[model samples]
Target: MNWNQFGYICRVKSSKTLSTEQKLQLCSESHLQIYKDNGSHSELAHNIAWQIAEDEETSQKQTACYKNIPDLINEFKFEHKGWLIYLTAVFIIYCFTSQLYQSFVVPQFVEMYSSFSPSLSATFDYYLTYWYVPIMLLALLLIIIVMAIIKLKNASSLTTTTPFSGMYNILLPRRLRNEYDALIAIIEFPYAYKKGFKATTAETIHFEKCESLGLELNDEFTVLLKQKLMSFNAMAKSYINKLVILYGIVIVVSVYLFVKMAYQPIFMMGEVL
Candidate 1:
């Protein structure tokens, strides 16, 4: 009755002792942790279950799987809402600092230009002659373009943003289609496993699909497939932590720069005039 079904195929080393249930449980639990690390823990654990089938375990019962990509993407969108706040803060600070910088430096340059060129009776007219507006406008345009690109990249990364219907029609079922009605589970294996999912799953699927399609598993392919899942866990942990820390630092630095620039001119002018 569960119309939604999901699965992946994995190659097993003869030495690895985990039963199929144990493997599914490990992957299922780890996927939960990864999602939690990405945001505040949510009740959507049922959404991202893994239905991983192993090569050696063809005769084994299928594990219940859940497709959590939708949920995960939703949660990601929620978590990244802070980024909008950070960007707004950065923009406000940038505008305030830019104005402050021009204010402080402009008057001094105007006085110097007027004194040097006595014929320039009006300091404001002298300052206007240089046309700083175009340069500022160009800088503003560049900032907007860069911000637009960053926003587009982030938007593209959101899972649902892609029109998966076209490619999804071709690629999804070839791997998991034959697996019978089971809970469609979603699991966040490390991003490195992003590519490995297909190759590794293909190891098991090729063998399973072989009989249906008339093919056999190769020993060399089996050996290579076993390495992919165990490999990415460490790399994902390090990279994710580094990314979060860097984002936080950028937000803090933007705030500090804004406050410093806004106040320094008033303090200096008080002292000077």
Candidate 2:
């Protein structure tokens, strides 16, 4: 079953009504169990189940977070659906137009121009030959830059295994920084803590800071985390919108330039004829 169904079951089967072994058995027999062997459950579900069986307060916190997972995921998908559709449409259009021009339009135009003007035909041939060179080079450059950035990030001393640490280290706005911090603190760190894993230096520091500030890791904290998550999703959608617009502009401008180049020769040939 999906997380929503599992969460609903958990909610219905209150801890006060069920013993710790019952909760553990529920987790093991559920779809969350990845292996038939003893104690081999999906990490998140296992951690949540263990937390619930261990402490009443932590159980309440985890139960609240567990029930909200579906809403959180749905909200993210809803926020970015429009931009995703735009991106898919643009990609399809670009691919279809490029294929159609190369397969049908190019040959016809080359034949027509060749019969009328050899120079124009040569110009068309040259453009057709090299049109993709710059695009390929730019793509290569972007790949190289991304690889370099990843390498640098890996080599940096500040690097941690925190979920959003890479993004957190980037030059994000103060608001996004807070959201990333909250994500790590409320979600990831707690899971790691419950799973008996050693906290990384960054996680330890964040937890200390939260404690120093007298932050309670309660239902209110979960609500704050949910808000931060939604805010981050909104920011992600904004970035995606900007990227889609920028990419659409690039595609339009490239097509325009190609059309102008292709037609300019035809116009010159017409004038000569």
Candidate 3:
């Protein structure tokens, strides 16, 4: 059947602690063999034991935690959809601005220069005729490259998500803040949404599982996990803040560059060359 139905079956079947009636309530009929409702406790327990054993085996195999590369790529692509539109608009604006400058403004100014002096008229004509297109295209290409680098680096680099990487995921845009929130939702999807509860439950499950094995946790374990979550949140905020500042800097620098380039003089030859 559908993925939703499959997921329900998996979740119910995976829970050894669940009862037969509980399984019936939660799962559909087709998956009953995987999670038979009226089975003996010993049989149910055996299935659960086997399931746990299998889960542990798969967990060990799968738990060699590499980068969540696929999820990240998908998330990045989804997030950049709006950014793609924005980039398109920016490109259009740049093209329109460049065209308007060349067509209406530059020629008029050239004519005005020619009226002022025959010597300068040839220089202004050369300014428009030779260099304008290449320079504008180069600038636009550089901007696109720089923006691409920033986005790709942000998506791939290790930060708070890394184990013992010591890096933080701080400084982000509000949209990135939303992204982190979305990531947090994914992290907590197995449980209901409650911030403190999610944290406590995660900690409790971890501790209880280990404690059930009669293993003594180092005194620092709780402290460490708590610190990690706190650091993750802080770093996320910092990342957003940094992004905002970076965007501000980009805008400011871009405006300054545009104005500087627009007003700067263009000349072909020196005194005698």
Candidate 4:
């Protein structure tokens, strides 16, 4: 009851022409190869049951995979346990940092912002003189972070989301990317995002989701689904890249600022004579 089997199940139910042997092979061989291509084979191994079942009925009827919407929405769905753990860790970190910022940084920054009036002020108020540069950089950093989180979420899914409740899902893009990479061969869809890094097509994946949600697939629905899947990887990449940039800027700024404030040479030669 893993992605390979679930994909196989969906494939068996959705596909009208592919024979049993074809279905069997698709479940057994194709997805693993797909996993190795774009995602870590390790992730696939964590999510899939590699051994062939002795009977067809058992293979077809296995209930271990994610079945319905409720579980899918509320439960952990990644093929890799490590990613789930990692995402949980990040979410915790985000929560603490957000709290600390709200408690301490926000009030101070707010005070600084209030000093922006010309009639009441000099060129540099106490807040403005010390905080102006840090504030500007932090503002840029926060804007980039918010935008990246939003973009990453969009790339992985097209469903209604609850941000606070969905903390563990920050890593959804990575999982989706892996799925696309490994399953693209069986899915036969071009990776629409990164060069030489392919994933399953939305054309291939959207219907599976529709079925999971028990939604009827009509022309309108198909078009909507296609749009969601088409640029998902691109969105995910955009988000991940932005996050990387944010982290990089944060590290550089923190180090530079700390050094400037903590160490100052009052005299160039320090009374060398």
Best by TM-score: 2
Q: Report every candidate's CA lDDT.
A: 0.36, 0.52, 0.41, 0.41
Best by lDDT: 2
Quality of model 1 by C-alpha lDDT? 0.36
Model 4 misplaced regions, further than 4 Å: 1-130, 160-242, 266-273
Please list all clashing residue pairs in model 2, or write none if there are none: none
For candidate 3, the per-residue lDDT at 121 reads 50
lDDT digits (tens) for residues 79-150 of candidate 1: 334544554565566567656646785566455545643423253452345335434543454444344334
> Which is superior by lDDT, 1 or 3?
3
Residue 130 miss distance in model 4 (angstroms): 4.3
The best-first sequence of candidates by TM-score reads: 2, 3, 4, 1
The residue-by-residue lDDT of candidate 2 on 1-273, one tens digit each, is 343444554563445677766766765655444333422123444344444444655664446445554455444442333544555565666667777887898888787777862456665666687767545543443343334333322211112223334543553345544554555455555445546655454534555467458664444545655665666666644544454455656666777777887899867767978
Lowest summed lDDT window (length 10), candidate 1:
177-186
Give the worst 10-residue stretch by lDDT in candidate 2: 152-161
Decoy 3 TM-score against native: 0.38
In candidate 1, position 128 carries an lDDT of 45
| RMSD to the hidden true structure, all candidates | 13.4, 8.0, 12.8, 15.2
